[model samples]
Target: MFRQLKKAATFAAAVLATTTLVSTAQAADYPEKAITLVVPYGAGGASDLAGRALAETARNYTNEQPVVVVNKTGNGGMNGARYVTEQKPDGYTLLLSRVGMALYPAVYTDSPVAWDDYTFLGILESTPMILAVNANSDIKTVDELLAKIKSSNGATTYAASGPTAIDGFTVQALLADADLDPLSASTLVPYKGGSALAAALLGGHVDFLAIAAGSLMPHIEAGKMRALMVYAPKRMDALPDVPTAKELGYNLAGQVDGWSALFAPKDLPEDVVAKWKDILSNVATNDQWLDLAKKRGSVSVVGDQDPAAFVKSQYELYNGMAKKFGYIQ
Candidate 1:
């Protein structure tokens, strides 16, 4: 009986050793195929553009496998976000998500995806929200837009992808700053996605739009839309003519910035997380990435701070802003 017990113990030890070795080898051999980045919104939107740009520049640091972006739009970004949580946590499938993920709790009382359900890699880039109107519209300046909102008295309209979206939140905050009744001073038109919002704006369904600056660069350059003011500390190089809210003497605060980050399924291997952080850290400093972001009218923000902390702060910030604007309890 003693001999049998000793033999069993030996077998158990061997199995444990072999398991550790296999895990180590797997970590070393990770990312053998293409990495898929799931953007929760449709193509041509700000998130899609930033995800594509990051994937394109990630090849410079990736181990030869290309990073592909897939758009699974719906449910105000919850659909695509939840889809990634169901995928394998092998660092192969990642979510290039937005501020909406952090704002979910404040916006949705029963959210399907928790902020802690994913491992946040880091914030990749951010673009200030742009307040724009169709080029042919008589309202061309921020003051004019405000006057229209005040004079129209719940008649003048603005389009946003959704009530919980960053753009929508910006519109709400803008009204709050101007001391205008959000519900009465203007009608907030909601759409399913940025593409739809763009259509509504261009087709004259809404008087104006508040969206990521990068998303409207093409339209503005094509003479289809006119940018009034950006919600940033200063004007962007790409859109140098557009003044900031501060420059225009309107303080919309820091809550209007739009950002995108990378996330993986929860319980990702430590080594895999570290690998991604390193890869993305490199991508943040890459000149090509910066130039691409500039061309897209976005700015690259790669801070050395822990990503988890950054995400937490953003969640808190958005939650506070939502409560202030009466978006949630």
Candidate 2:
């Protein structure tokens, strides 16, 4: 009986050792093929541009393995986010996370994805929000725009990715701060991506919009759009004359800004996570990545904070805002 028990224990130990070895080998051989970096928004948007830049720069550290970006737009950016969470956590499928990742779960009681569903690799960049109107529009300032909305009695429309998205929250929070009904003071016209949101304002379909500065900077510079205010902690260097929401006393709007980060399905191996941390560190300092961010009116912020803690803090902030602004109970 003693001999039989000893033999069983030895077999179990060998099995465990083999399993550990195989898992280690798998993690070490990560990205043997091209890795898919899914962008939750459409092409020509801030998230897409950030994903492509990171993918391009990551090649230097990835041994030339391609990081292919795939856009899966819809449902206020949840469709793509959900798709990524459902993928294998093999370090091959990743997400180019956006501000919507935190905002949606806070605002929507039935949000498809939770803020903590993915493993946050790191924050890539922050794209400040800009409130703007068509250059030809008669409205020239945020105050004038709010007055029009109040006088129009809900006729003034604004474009956003959706009511729960970061862009939408920017306008809603601003209205709420001004002692207006965020939902009824103006109409919210939903668009799928940044390009669509910008087009709505430029084509006169929507009266105004507050969205990522990267998507609106070109038009603002080209004299096609007039920026009313910036939704960042400080004024952007490119738009130094524009006042920030904090300076204007819109606390809620001032707290909300657009950002992009890297994420993967939860439960990723530690080895894989370490590998990505090294790659992202290199990409953050790459000249090409820095130049792209500068031209897009964004600030590169990789490794500036703990990604998981930053995401959690953002969730807590929006959750509090949702409760305060009546978006949730």
Candidate 3:
């Protein structure tokens, strides 16, 4: 009886030990080295602002050294995306990408990557752009601006981030609805970033600018820039008086994917993915994250609730918009 009991005890101990090993092996084996996060756009852009915030806060969740941001930019963010998709499926490498990730492929026929080849961690925040003019300008509302542009007939100029930017497209979409050339009512002035465009608005270098909500808040409070319209469905607290684009006479409607999220190689171990999701989810709801988001001029949303739903919705959204706009052939 003693020999039988001893054998049973040893077998039970072996099974428990095996279970422990299996559970911890992947957790330990993963991220054994520094992780490199690739930001698709050049530094100082909206993508960089959100990416840096994530890198700064991700360390708390990663419970290790912060992930390093590697800028691999070109072809409006396609160059770095191609590189990230081709990288090894280790959790150590990630891509801090934008909505353009999905939209670009749908819009540009020659884009080199596909959606199924990668994994999404989740979104960090959502920002809406506004059409802003100097506080001293005569265009006080969306109606006034539209009237002026239509009367001016391509004489009025507005600033945008770049050629294929959401701001640019928003302008295009609005114009298309009004039966005017996206570039017809206004000349599209190019600037390096939202900040630069905002600066131009303040300095009176341009007639108006299409800039993000947070980026324009300070100026709005100081009465430097007047908001004509916002892209969001409802009014934002900072600028309640500004009407949404849909509220204007035009039927223009949109919510560009101005969010930042986590991305891992498609083949990362499931345990690692779960660990990251858990870590990020905790950080998203934490006070530090909320404060950081406020400072950055964005709303706090993360993990399953925000990004997961947005990702699935946006996959449909961008594809549908791209097809509707003829941006895609």
Candidate 4:
């Protein structure tokens, strides 16, 4: 009787020990500390503004400490992305990346990294890019500008946000199709952000800039600039008179739209990633979030927050564009 009782007690204790271990290993209430939201662009840029707004809203979704917004601008978000990838995958460090994140791999052959390195939460918003110039500039339309640049015989320059940025290739591709020879007749000046480019344009430092539609709307309202054209397949209702690049004899259509999304390191605990996915999925549908997105001209969308699907989609879209532009095989 004593031996049998001892065996029973010993087995019960061992079972309890194993259960405790497994239970403890499971995900607990996550985000125990402050979360860092890294923006891959400079401050006051469109991406930074959108990212901060999202971070603020995300804070309300949890009772943990407020999220911190960090600008890690370098190599057009590659540095920031690599930084996040190198961090411990506990969901403490998150990347709020724009379309440039995907464009990087597309533009650079044998890129040092790939999108699969990090877990994409979901796309926050996406919008189309546009062509804008100072209101007082002699060039009033896309046709006029093209004629001027081709006729001037003097080099013209354009301001860009970054190399891997959507503006980089989209604008370059536009010039490429025009047979205008961007490098031969135009200088491409890459600034850190749109606001800076706007400043430069206002100060007569740059000839013009190709920015997303939303970023230039405020200035257009102020009468400081006028949109030459909106880079969409169809004319945007906001400015119907302006023709798309395609309508004006350019094959480009809706190629300039960009997006921002959240990502965590791939090593994140599945439960932690799940918790964020759940919270953000609901957050993606919030009225306040939608309103904010509208204000920025970003379309709030219900998308695949699954990292695998997200990365795959990015790979396909960007990779295809790269191949079409002859930037990749």
- Each candidate: RMSD: 2.6, 2.1, 5.5, 4.5
Which residues of candidate 1, in runs, are more than 4 Å off?
Answer: 1-10, 138-140, 246-253
> Relative to the unseen true structure, what is the C-alpha lDDT of residue 317 in candidate 3, on a scale of 0 to 100?
63
Candidate number of the best TM-score: 2
* Greater-TM-score candidate between 1 and 3: 1
Cα lDDT over the full model 4: 0.74
Q: TM-score, each model?
A: 0.89, 0.92, 0.84, 0.80
State the C-alpha lDDT per candidate.
0.82, 0.90, 0.74, 0.74
Across 197-290, the per-residue lDDT of candidate 1 in tens digits comes to: 7778999999998888776878988999988888875788878888887776665544467888889999899988888877888898899889
Tens digits of per-residue lDDT for model 4 on 1-329? 99999999999999999987764565465666789999977887778878887887888775556889999877767888888888988888999877777778766866555767887677777665778788889888777777777876746778886544677666666776678654455677877667777777777888888877667777877888888877754676567677777777765434555677888888777778777877788778788777777776666654645545655666666677577655666
lDDT tens per residue, model 2, 113-150: 99999988999998999999999999888889888988
Worst 10 residues of 4 by lDDT: 302-311
Error of 4 at 170 (Å): 2.7
- Which candidate would rank higher by TM-score, 2 or 4? 2
List, in order, the clash count of every candidate structure: 0, 0, 0, 0
